[model samples]
Target: MNILIVHAHPEAQSFTTALKSTAQQSFEQQGHQVEISDLYMMKFNPVASQDDFTELNQPEYFNYALEQRNALKQNHLAADIEIEIEKVKRADLVIFTFPLYWTSVPAILKGWIDRVFVSGLFYGGKRFYNHGGMAGKKAMLCFTLGGRDYMFGENSIHGPIEQYLSPIQRGTLAYAGFEVLPPFIAYHVPYISQKDRQDILVDFEKYLKHLDELQPLKFPVLENFDEKMQPLN
Candidate 1:
């Protein structure tokens, strides 16, 4: 299967980078083709603006969604966005690797989502959730965090880890129609020993090797809702 890894850490030697490398090697060992988008190395611009379009749809009032749809139809999207879209189109699975920042994805990665998951390309109209533009694709997250695993559970200070990740998993990936996988998280990486870190890498390899056998997170189907988007009785 074709796989795309979107890596968003600034430091090459960081634990997050190690996880990215581990995933690449593991997938390749299983004979899967892999591609990586190293955002920092590529100097990917994370901000969205009028500059993203070759020409504006409404020059008087800039509505990003309107401009994006127009640009996509005109084949006038920004070069970088076009490239990213092509990568997503080719990949059967897309993995995101980053360090947790402020209880969410790094700004660069979030911007990547905003810019690349464009209207008329990734999602629009009734094409969302199970019927989204990217319906058959899969997405997973691999991240490292400074906090201990226990700290993120229901009875802990930070609450459930899934709560912190719901925005990305459900709002972003699921909304785009990706079959989201359970995340592989390396908790307290900075506080762990080198041996522990290596062990984590080994475990990550095992996870990748068994990726095909893993079940995706469950989500509601479009049929579950009525035209107004309320759950049908």
Candidate 2:
């Protein structure tokens, strides 16, 4: 299978990058073709602007999504976005490797999503969730966090980790029609020992080997919803 790993960490020696490396090695060892998009090393621009398009559909007003649609149709999307989109298209699975920032993805990664997951291509009106343009693809998150596993739960200070991840997992990836998998998280990396980190890497390698067995996370399916997107039940 073709796999794409989008890595988003500034420091190459950081544990986050280590995990990214581990994933790449593991996937390659399994005989799968792997591609890496090192956002920081690539100096990927994270900001959205009029500069993304060669020519504007409506020069008077700025609508990013509409412009994306127009650009896609005209094949006028910026070269960088087109390249990333092609990478996504070629991959059967896309792995996002990053360190959790403010309970969300790093800005660069988010920007990658905003620009690459274009309007007419990745998603559009009534074309989200199971019906999205990327319906056949799979997406998974592999991240490191400073928070301890105990620090999050229904009875804990921060509530469930799933709660913090819902926006990215459910709102974005699943909404874009990726069969979202359970995330592989390296918890409390800042406080963990080197041996512990190494153990996590070993465990992660095993996780990657079992990809076919991992059940995708459940999300809303359009079949159960009416035209207005309300549950038909």
Which candidate leads the pack in lDDT?
A: 2
Overall lDDT per candidate, in order of appearance:
0.92, 0.93
Provide the global lDDT of candidate 2 against the true structure: 0.93
Over 4 Å off, model 1: 224-233
What shift in Å separates residue 23 of candidate 1 from its native position after superposition?
A: 0.8
Cα lDDT of model 2 by residue, 2-101, tens digit:
9999999999999999999998999888899999999999999999999999999999999999999999999989999999999999999999999999
Per-residue CA lDDT of model 1 for 1-233, tens digit only, reads: 99999999999999899999999998888899999999999999999999999888899999998788889998889999999999999999999999999999999999999999998667777768998789999999999999998888878999999998999999989998999999999999999999999999999999998888999999878775456753211
lDDT comparing candidate 1 with the true structure? 0.92
